[model samples]
Target: MVIDDSSAMRLILGRIMRSLGFDVVEAPNGAEAIARLQSGAMPEIALVDWNMPVMDGLAFVNAVRREEKWRQITLMMVTTESEQSQIVRALAAGAHEYVIKPFTPDAIADKLALLGVLAY
Candidate 1:
């Protein structure tokens, strides 16, 4: 799943995911992502963006981590939040990986490979 407030970002991420052989789903914000989850949509991984109108990525990470049923889902922050503290906080909140914005598709692919979500 690609969760971002910007439809353009979601589209770009969706294309990247598709190139990596993933079937993508999209949510405009964390709230919608949660709603989808509640509706039984379970994607293996979610590429989440920070700084959203509804619920931010950190909150989403915390919410997902608090749920046992969603334990196996991998969360990756694909955002512009590049502060070291923000990265630590996201990781601490159960985000498996973090990628800053303005990233190349190779960077995203590398991170997914590192997380074992994609084969090299």
Candidate 2:
């Protein structure tokens, strides 16, 4: 799932995910993304944006980690959250991977590879 409030960002990330062989589900906010998950959307991996309306990514990460049924889903932070402290906080919140904004597909691919989520 691609969680971002910006339509352009969502479009870009959706394209990237599809290029990487994923059929993505999109949400404009963390709450909506969670709603989708509850509504039977089983995305193996979620590429989440940090800043959003309704609910932010950090809150979403904490929420996702709290759910036992969704534990199998890999959570990756894909956003402009470049601050070191913020990154640590996000990682400590159970995010599986992190990718900064303006990152190339290779960067995302590399992190996904490390997490064993990228298609072979």
Question: Who wins the TM-score comparison?
Answer: 1
Alpha-carbon TM-score of each model against the true structure? 0.98, 0.96
Give me the displacement of residue 88 in model 2, in angstroms: 0.6
Q: Which is the leading candidate under lDDT?
A: 1
Model 1 lDDT per residue over 15-80, tens place: 999999999999999999999999999999999999998899999999999999999999999999
Q: In candidate 1, which residue pairs clash?
A: none
Lowest summed-lDDT stretch of 10 residues in model 1? Answer: 50-59
Candidate 2 TM-score versus the reference? 0.96
Candidate 1 Cα deviation (angstroms), residue 94:
0.6
Q: Which portions of model 1 show Cα errors greater than 4 Å? A: none
Q: Write model 2 residue lDDT over 4-112, tens digit each, in one string.
A: 9999989988998899898988999999999999998888999899999999999999999999999999999999989999999999999998999999878888898
The Cα RMSD of model 2 versus the native structure comes to: 1.0
